[model samples]
Target: MEAVFSKEIQSGLDQARVASMKKSSRLRVCADGKKQTVLRMWKTGFAMEADAPDMRGMVDLYDGSIHLFRCLVVTTAEESGERHYEFKRATAVRGTPALDFETPEHAPAGLIEDAR
Candidate 1:
């Protein structure tokens, strides 16, 4: 998985969801700022066409609503030269921020843990 700060999605999200475009985007890092990379963030919400229903004569017409978020982080040693870019999808629940990005699938456990 790569953490890509998708510029296209970010711009589109900023216009559609005005409140979520925060100014700061820094990676979680060690005390010396030498171990991690954090990139910009873009959050948006959209819907996709749903697949057909199961047997029994019911068909789902919509894929339900989904939230999309992208982030750009530098590649870790584990990832080799590839940059870290991410895209997350989550369901929209009541009272939840509609455009918040989901957690990274492979974030480092911690400084000491990652060092191992």
Candidate 2:
């Protein structure tokens, strides 16, 4: 027999599940140009839906829309039945725009590397 829960009971359970979860993050995964929602995440690893792309090895992590990291990862089917990925290496990426202003010719020379 199928059991049903009242709206209030269901809502309570939903709220409980959310409350029991780790701190929510805007983190997401992008691989082979396909983006997938991050189901769960941790310092060393993260999980995406099991139906996510079979592509693995290298993945780019994003916070909502901003690029955050490049990770070398390996996949495993966790006991929880989720497609889990463990990070073998994670490197932070930063966007640095070229300096818009150029030093005046009168400015004292800094270094040969700076001229390059």
Candidate 3:
């Protein structure tokens, strides 16, 4: 499948990685505080390494719900040898597409505003 990331997002992902050393594990993935985040990325593969502090701890959608897990960040060379991350303390998550935008709807006459 095609990789799904914009140039800006890609750049941010790259910047998140720490410089790889001969025997250093610089990648860190952390669990999110919100339950919904854990529900969003399960099952979807992590072909490329994600940004730590940002993409870390995101719940992957496994069988059905948001489950927590961890991934090791490695260099491209290291990934080429073995690309799959081993998840631990995981919870199942259901994937959901991110919102593109949010805007106020044009109100019609007699429409009650929700903010009251």
Clashes of each: 8, 0, 15
Candidate 3 runs further than 4 Å off: 1-46, 49-58, 62-77, 81-83, 94-116
**If scored against the real structure, what TM-score would every candidate get?**
0.16, 0.58, 0.19
Better of 2 and 3 by TM-score: 2
The TM-score that candidate 2 achieves is: 0.58
lDDT of 2 at 62: 94
Off by over 4 Å in 2: 1-25, 97-116
| C-alpha lDDT of residue 35 in model 1 | 26
Q: Candidate 1 residues 10-100, lDDT tens each?
A: 6565444422311232322221222222323234321111111111211111112221222222222212212322233323334465656
lDDT of 1 at 50: 17
**TM-score, predicted candidate 1 vs. hidden true structure:** 0.16
Residue 42's lDDT within candidate 3 is: 29
RMSD in Å for all candidates: 22.4, 9.7, 15.1
Model 1: ten consecutive residues of lowest lDDT: 46-55
Q: Global lDDT of each model?
A: 0.29, 0.74, 0.36
Judging by TM-score against the true structure, name the best candidate.
2
Ranked candidates, highest lDDT first: 2, 3, 1
In terms of lDDT, which candidate is strongest? 2
Encode model 3's per-residue lDDT on 1-116: one tens digit a residue. Answer: 89989878876555444223212432223335432112112243333233222333334332233233334322232232123333444443335655688645974547676996
How do these models rank on TM-score, best leading? 2, 3, 1
Error of 3 at 90 (Å): 2.5
